[model samples]
Target: MTDHTPSSRSAARATRPVRTKALSALVHGICLSLLVGTVAPAWAQFKASPAVSPRIPGNRSLSTELKIEGMQATTDYILAVVNQEPITHTDVDKRVARITDTAPAGSRLPPPEELRQQVLDALIDEKVQISHAKTIGMDISDQELDASIENIAAQNQMTLEDLRNRMQSDGLDFQRYRNSLREQMLLQRLRDREVNSRIQITEDELTTFMKEDPAAQAEVALNVAHILIAVPEKATQVQVAALLSKAQAIQERAAQGANFAQLAKDNSADTKTKDQGGALGLRPASRLPELFVATTTKLKVGQVAPVVRSNAGFHIIKLIERENSAQATYTQQRARHILLRTSPQQPAREQIDRMNDIRKQIVGGQTSFAQMARQYSEDGSGARGGDLGWAAPGQFVPEFEKALTALQPGQISEPVVSRYGVHLIQLIERREVQLTEQQQREAARSVLRERRFEPTYEEWARELRAAAWIEMRDAP
Candidate 1:
């Protein structure tokens, strides 16, 4: 995903609500558990390493022979051993190279030695976790591993062959890459099994949590769209005036019932969201900028806010949707889908084409959506004509929720691919309803569980590390 950080040109560029890194990483085919401080390299969170010129040597693992795109081959030797598994110097080097290469622009780097130590520690943790997983008989089936690779390819909008070729071109060995993914999968499953099971929130604890953090109980989520008219840093007063006038005109058009999305597509200076009709998606008030939340808080759905000036530019804001816990109300969506799970025999593209054909039949009136769904959908809901029932926000995965949210009531979505499978979704309807006491408590519990997860996982990992047999070796 492109960094949403503001550029030197404008702070408005950074005004887009931040998405959770896990979801973003998943969408981009990076391992999700890596974002949550799992065994994988914490590249995004860690500082980069200084450049190093590696010397090629005879003693190297087959995996280390595949050098990263701009990095030279390095001598490989044992750096550490965990449960009889060797963590090599090349292993640490490759991770450091990746971190250096992909670290966000303008990020600082730690001393080379310090960064290497961090990478080595992460590798040791991974080896320990993988060993534990094997000891516990936790293994990824071949079919499951294949499915994961296929999902990654699909998420990247590539065929399996394309993904393979891309990896090869980037100096990555296909088998080694597969092995790495398998290890990540094992580590994630192990953490979920060992860590998630340990977290228990009682009813009284939930009540206390909600009472202490009332804002959590009465959270407000907003879906806001904006059209930005950027003013350059060195702009004269005349230039600023011109941009402000342009913003005001756009705001007027939006207020008078012009299509905000269309206006955004035509004129919004914010590149990241303009393509998506300027919507930043539904996010908590805390996630959005203070100025934006404050501006749109009082606006009814579909209402527009007046032109506002900021350091970045002039903005024309529109309220798309709002869910307020204070009002004890939230929007619920009733959607149905025709799902076709992908397999090695059935490629994602073929399944997608099949779904498209099904969509065509439904849209052409040759068959009803429900009829097609009942006849062909592979999901459990197929028997019920693909009905998913009424669901509130976050009831579905991120990709599914995004597709569902984009559809108007009674409108059918184009085939959407999620981790589950390809889906042909139709939004039946949406309603705003009051939250029941039971639902409120459940929500509180959910929040508390998430809050507790990181600390619990860290403690669990520390215990595992302490118990593992580890030995440090001299660098050759």
Candidate 2:
């Protein structure tokens, strides 16, 4: 949903008099969760990390008289319990709106009871995960929270006061909304620690996946868009026939030049792509569903594949574009750095001071970059005169990359603090390289990681649910 322009939100509040209806409109209609794309691995999948959505159509409500049994309940109403943390009806409503918002604009909602149950379950799972984060002492600092809130407001093209005022008029508490944003960031960090860090593609596994299998080595990423005609898990012959006919009709319409995205949004049952007009994004063939890869591989760009059936549903796919993985160009840098990792004993300021001194020494000719790195640096590269042979784009984290990219071929960087430590980076040279044999294996490792990300994340989420103590309260 597009953000509420100040004028529009003001108009909404003025016409409604009280904020309840306007807030619901915000929750169910225009308001959105904070998410923009980060660099995802080249795989066609849902971009939004599926978290329980929290949308209370208007500003956070503190009203006493406006209580509607289940829907208008306050902070005290317990809808479910996860690890003894109370999940309120308001929480469930917000999440339900969030979930429904992700669905195609006109997609049919589940029965209310069913939708509520699903939202409750998702919230419980989320609560347990959040509880685990707290138990481990993972926290968002005030500075970090403030920055994230600012980012969210910027993304919505609003100032912080503008967002707060809009929420205020709708009866949504601005502070609680900020808390929600912080939790979203926390969940992301928790998953990066628990799920992403755990998905390791070992050298042996990568080698076998690439070299041992001739086919895997030649795998490519395809840009595929698909419209799904969903068939229920079980159906009679009559239901099957109806679905197949519907799928065929949609295919013929797309073949005849109807807007595929609009067609998919209006008709497709695949929730992930329904709103996207059926864009699956780019997916490595190896990671794609076997049926999808096989069917679409035979077609050229702009050609529609025949409707393919699986247990879930019928897929009508269009081949958008394809790229050869072998043709991937990689930028490589020969760099080195002197590191001073901050510890409880050595604070960040001390580390920065030390690196600044080291840089001064290098400039004064008292020591070379390599000599200083060996004597004062705290990394494995210190042994090699601070030479990082050749590194690729994603080989370093974003902080380090930003620092590295700012250096000239022979220049020294001011001390930069990354997660690993404080570093004074020096660039020796940079060059573009084709995928060498070694690089191919590394690329294959990335492919394996991409393949495993969704499934691994799903498994981790499932484990979180399974391990939690959940008690469902009777429906209000």
Candidate 3:
């Protein structure tokens, strides 16, 4: 993670900003989504059926059920061993079950034998990586582990106690669950350190990437105001024609110098932005819906586009502003957040409830946001009225970023759960800025790193597995 230095006004809370990191992609890939499946205990039921082949010692068929010591009676056997660490038949079954359960609807799976071999290979690779992580003295602290568990609980909308009780109800040992989480964290840390260190992006590569990347080339920011004449679902053709006529008339009025804002305020059906003069605010072309971007692409400022029909209805759009510069620019946001750190002492649900009340008070004008933040926020930013200064995309974690993007200026978001803690975020404002030369290079570097992360990780894992002593025991 890279630390962000706050502006002079908020310098006292310089360290309070949630640092940005290139590992956000990896976090989502290896930590958040994977942990949900990897840590959850799966109980596989192996029904008694006729065996296709005779069961040999140390070579049990899939249908064979054998009682194992210190565990429930189930069909289990040693499948492989990596550095003396055994992978069991039960482990494979559980993994297979998870894959099957989580597979997208209508997706096809490989043949059973092929799938089993693939799962076994993946298990061996995991064992090798875990062994290497431990060998390198990489470790996850108890505090970090606790935070990760809390994050998982928050993501599931459960309190810490609720998570514990849910796990117990599912017949999973709490300590075992914690161990699984720790392992995942260790794996994430290991990959971030090792894989990132291997990637190198040169100035030439950066320049080429900037030129060749389609998104980078078309770096345009747009501010558009729209008036929607909504067409109700299953409406008659006459009703549709009437709505279309209304939209065309509004577009004509807007083009003929009628007050667009007033027209939107009075006639626009989009409740969220209608009162804001139908302004969608400044956003990059990538952030705006494709329909809006397409309609406004060739429009000059103050020009009104012809009425366009969509699934929702007809839209009369005005191009408020367009920034299509030679230099890449993006919409940056200045947001402030009141963070409440969650722990066993103050569970997530309690903190969430508290944040809700605080939001209500601030919204109702009973208390100022800054005052409440100063009184209740746990982070150093509290001293600076919880200001997180100007930030570009990818500066915050994905969960935080998603919530921040959804809020308008001065709008406080509902309690947002991130790995760090729960936060009540208020977007201060947004601005469009051209990236400096150095900033552009840095942005290119980030993109290059993301592109390299996956392949580098795979190569690193393969190397670890090849160096380890892997023995395949039973072939099933």
Candidate 4:
């Protein structure tokens, strides 16, 4: 097996989260501090340290941790050597065990080796993202990471201390749990940076696509607001009534012209978007609780509605924005770009120079933008000469689409930085986007891309594994 360990790989894998099922089990939602001093005595199970920890300068704990990890018995092989890393049978066994624990009691589980291989593949892909993140110098602060961890733990119905103790009882180490949280957080950051930040879903595209599927088009947008009081899933009748009354009072205040958004900010317990002034932006009406949609359509913009109760919490909703079922206006835009990729490992300047060089070439007419995009655009659409086919407003990354929409046909944009990379774009054509055959094809493609993220991410993991260095040893 080929070995590609960074000169630094000898330090043992402790500081890096194990990226296995055990780590996922302990701190699935909560943050790292939940694991403090919670490691149980080594059991028969294979143990890998969770990698989420505050980075100490030259810390050697991870190496020591893994030396101990190897002491456990290996039950099965997880994956074949990729590059050189042997994802062991024991690793697979742990992942399957963890999955069984999380699954409903009677669920069928994957065979030992099959589950192991899948988990190992995912782990390798995660490593690619982590490695990429490091290249771009993207690091999560321990404070924010910890806060995220705490939120996750609370959701799992456990206190930080209790969660740690449970992990110990399961023969898992708390540090490994923290490391997993850190890694997942890091992956989220990278995904946002790599994909979401750069993706543009245009209003025209949404309209055209939905038009092809009457069901999708039939969906109406709901402008919703709520005053939430969080109660346990099994709250008493008196407690539930008290919470509902509190919601009613908040609604009364809202009807009296108290700042509805500010009221939500102050009183809403739906922390997800409460701080956004209780804005659940333009959701499909069907997805709203039946009572909410029924009342929402009856109110005009800025009108407060009656209180609505749902399993999530109690709420008094107000209508802030609404879209009638009328079809949206769309404008087709053709654009071209030259792109340069940046990662945490590379200095920003390295790619900046490359983008600038590409920009200079276009300006100097050394090569057309389309030719350059075919050669260098890192995006999937690069194959189409960076033609984002047709976009209406809101279709491209806001920054990119904004630049494109501002240009007349044949106008070229200056280099713009988006999460994906730096891009130089041009507008080639402009036309109103209404439902058309061309639009339907693109719409179907868009639907597929959204559906494909998880599988795509998994496949990407496999590809990374195929190219990475991994080491495996026989069960000791």
Candidate 5:
């Protein structure tokens, strides 16, 4: 994690963009796919280790093992400390360089020393979060971490050897990058448990906000999906020409109403997202990359955009759903489902067969869904007859959402496989509501959630740091 900058990269090879996952961190690991939110391309699940181990899941315990192994009394400078953990000048310098390297070109950046302080603050916050997550016994297994790396490689259209060689050539220590990755996943897991789980919005608050807030009521949301035809760096003229042709073909197929998700799964370079058909989740335009925002401006729901090129490569985009708050209205589905979880004992096929029979029982009027769900559903909703309640778009994951969209009221769907398990879905009824009470609450709940997330998390960070024994060492 020394002051290694991609701008000064030594690698002659360019990494391809994998538009797999989205977050506000360094993503893509390439020049082409850079966007406002860092494009995350890996997911590792590993057991937590020492303070240093949480940074990266690799076996190299550099923080503890290498700190003094080859040290000199005068060369290594102390920068800061949190508890007994030390931060070296090298740490500060690396972060400063990373920030500088990743900043948008032509944007005015602060002095390196000033950026050092900000980076230091961020590191301290990260250290506190990692410490907390470790204390709580959250760990990602090495196998899981390897899977993340594999996905990263796969998404970039490279093998693990290729990725390692690229990193080495770029003057980045591969082991150090893994450590950075580990810290990232650890922090994300902590937030999911501590911060994300606690925030809640009340029904009363939603009703009040909907009635009173005019401007807030008019915000728009777009549900977009994309396919990346990634072009590797330093591609030959012929290579670029072929990629353009491929992108054009994909775009043409999309416009002619080919199954976009299937196309994405079959052809998308970003494997992390191919399974979900490149679903980016539901988000506002403000949260999206400007390129996407502009591309979708004239597009309609269920419509496809022309092949759009960026630094990364060409994109075949689809506008899955969109909403205008000013004229906000949605058809809410009152639905319930019975889940037959795929376990070692039952397996996926058995679960599917069982679910089919359950659907038949309900459809054939042998028994009510609620009774069946109450008797057999493995999830909490079983007690309520699998009543998931009313949901607008984005309430459920994409697989479930897509299924729900297809069902007419009182019609049952074939067993659908989601991450949760196999489900037999029945849409009880559907109604179009204009700022309905339930709609307002759900929206306000989400709005309030977004409002509380950042500041609350910051406050939480400060609290953790406060509780730690941190000391600032004079920079030499």
Candidate 6:
């Protein structure tokens, strides 16, 4: 059923109140999970690492009586459980409050009871995953939790303090917010460990996969660099003209053998790439900004273009290299493990020591990587023996990719650290995949795996929600 339009509520509120409600609800409606573009103030003040969960001071009630005085209990008192965990009606109500106006301005909000049920269901699903995380012993460290919260705040374009104040003004409790954030972090970690880690494409597989992907097949990676003279956002036509002229002179210097990197560092207005000699990296030609593609595609590697104009400013582009994509396929080992985050208080040394010991035990035949993962690894992969099935070259963090690349079949990598945390990786098995075959068997496998992943992930979520204990009472 279509959701309800919240205009009635807006109409009932005074103008200023409506504006505040709209602003808060509108922004929250668009609030993305942990990863997203731009920073918000919420990220700054609410940063909590995985290790930062100080257990609730003590078990407490999970419901609050609304003080509406004359209003009756218009909504049903729903109590549900995911596996052994209970989800109170209040939990559902809170989520509904955040999402009531989320549908486009005109849609009707679902009935309060119905919305509560949905929220309850979702919370249950989340709990299942959390439970699975525990079974596999996945953990979020203090540092990672803090960084994720900070990142969310930044994405929302709010400083940490500002986000906290905004939440307070909106009647949202800080700890509740932290709990919500932690759950999301856990879900993401679980997905990575369960599904994403297992997905992989070999060089040949990637080659074939690329050939089949209309988007990739239609495009090629172009290595390019540029020198730009920019007009300030508020610059006048005259000022713009002067900047363009300056660009022309700089281009001349570049053409006359001045080092492009040095010149870019000194003169380019494209700050993102200026220090790297205006290098835009190996980006798909089709996706390059129109002006960039138009100018650079026409020039051979090492050739500099005449002045080009784009939204940012005027630019001179140079093509460095181009890679034509071909058929893709992969055959590789898949393994999983949990992660343990490192922090100043629980430094890398501590995590390293712990993981190293696990590695030693596993190596000495005292324990399996899977057992060690479940017992100790901090990554969500711990649920499944640190199995990241078959991955393509660039799928993992560079450090992880490097370590994985160095392992032989059945070989377990020494404890390796990535931005996420320390990991104990094991090599399952490696297989050769030929995309040239008619069935493109391996490619077909990859496609099937991709298709199955979503539902499997949903099931995994269901599993986590089935196993967690959550309460929704407001803080005292």
Pick the winner on TM-score between candidates 2 and 5. Answer: 2
Q: Write the per-residue lDDT of candidate 6 for residues 1-476, one digit (tens) a residue.
A: 01112222111011110000000000111122222111111111111121111111000101111111111133544376555676655555544554543232222334565555555555555566667776888886766666545433432445457667776665556666666566655655565567545555566865675578653333456788887676555678898899889888888877776788998998876656787988977754543555777777667778888887754477877788775433433344454544666554554446666877877888899977787766765544555565555654334543455676788878877766544446667667767553344334433444434444545555555444444564444323
* Candidate achieving the largest TM-score: 1
CA error at residue 384 for candidate 5, angstroms: 26
- Put down candidate 3 lDDT per residue, 1-476, tens digits, no spaces: 32233333322122211111212211111111242211111211111221111011110001111111122346778999989999888777666665555443223456577666666666676678779999989898898778767766776677678867766665556786577657656665666578767988887877888888855533567899998888775679999888888889888989999999999999988776789999987665654667999998778899999999876688899999886534646678998888887777877778888999999999999998889888988767888789888887756655677788999999999998766568899999999887776665564455455556556766777777779998888555
Per-residue lDDT tens digits for candidate 2, residues 286-362, read 64667888898679888887788875578789988886657765567888887776554565556676788889989
lDDT ranking, best first: 1, 3, 2, 5, 4, 6
True lDDT of residue 438, candidate 4? 47
Error of 6 at 292 (Å): 1.7
**TM of each candidate vs. truth:** 0.67, 0.56, 0.63, 0.40, 0.47, 0.41
Best by lDDT: 1
Where in model 4 is the C-alpha error above 4 Å?
Answer: 1-217, 286-298, 324-326, 330-336, 341-349, 352-390, 393-421, 424-476
The pairs that clash in candidate 3 are none
Which TM-score value belongs to model 4?
A: 0.40
Give candidate 1 misplaced runs (Cα > 4 Å).
1-44, 47-72, 220-282, 285-324
- Over 4 Å off, model 5: 1-76, 170-172, 221-323, 326-440
Q: Least lDDT summed over 10 consecutive residues: which range in candidate 3?
A: 53-62
The superposed Cα distance between candidate 3 and the true structure at residue 98, in angstroms, equals: 2.2
lDDT of 1 by residue, 380-448 (tens): 777778888887765565556778899999999998776556888999999988877776666556556
The lDDT for every candidate, in the order shown, is 0.68, 0.63, 0.66, 0.53, 0.61, 0.52
Which of the two candidates, 1 or 6, achieves a greater lDDT against the reference?
Answer: 1
Ranked by lDDT, the better of candidates 4 and 5 is 5
lDDT of 2 at 89: 78
What C-alpha lDDT does candidate 4 achieve relative to the native structure? Answer: 0.53
lDDT of 5 by residue, 1-476 (tens): 12123233211111211111122332212111212122321111111211211122111111111110111123568878776777777666554544555443223344456556655666676777777888889986665455555534433445567777776665556676676666665666676567656676676776676678642344467788989888775678899899999989999998999999999998887655678998787765545667987899898899999999876677899999887744666667788887776544554556777887888888899999999989988766777887877765545544466687899988888876543456778789988767654444455455555556656655666677778888888977
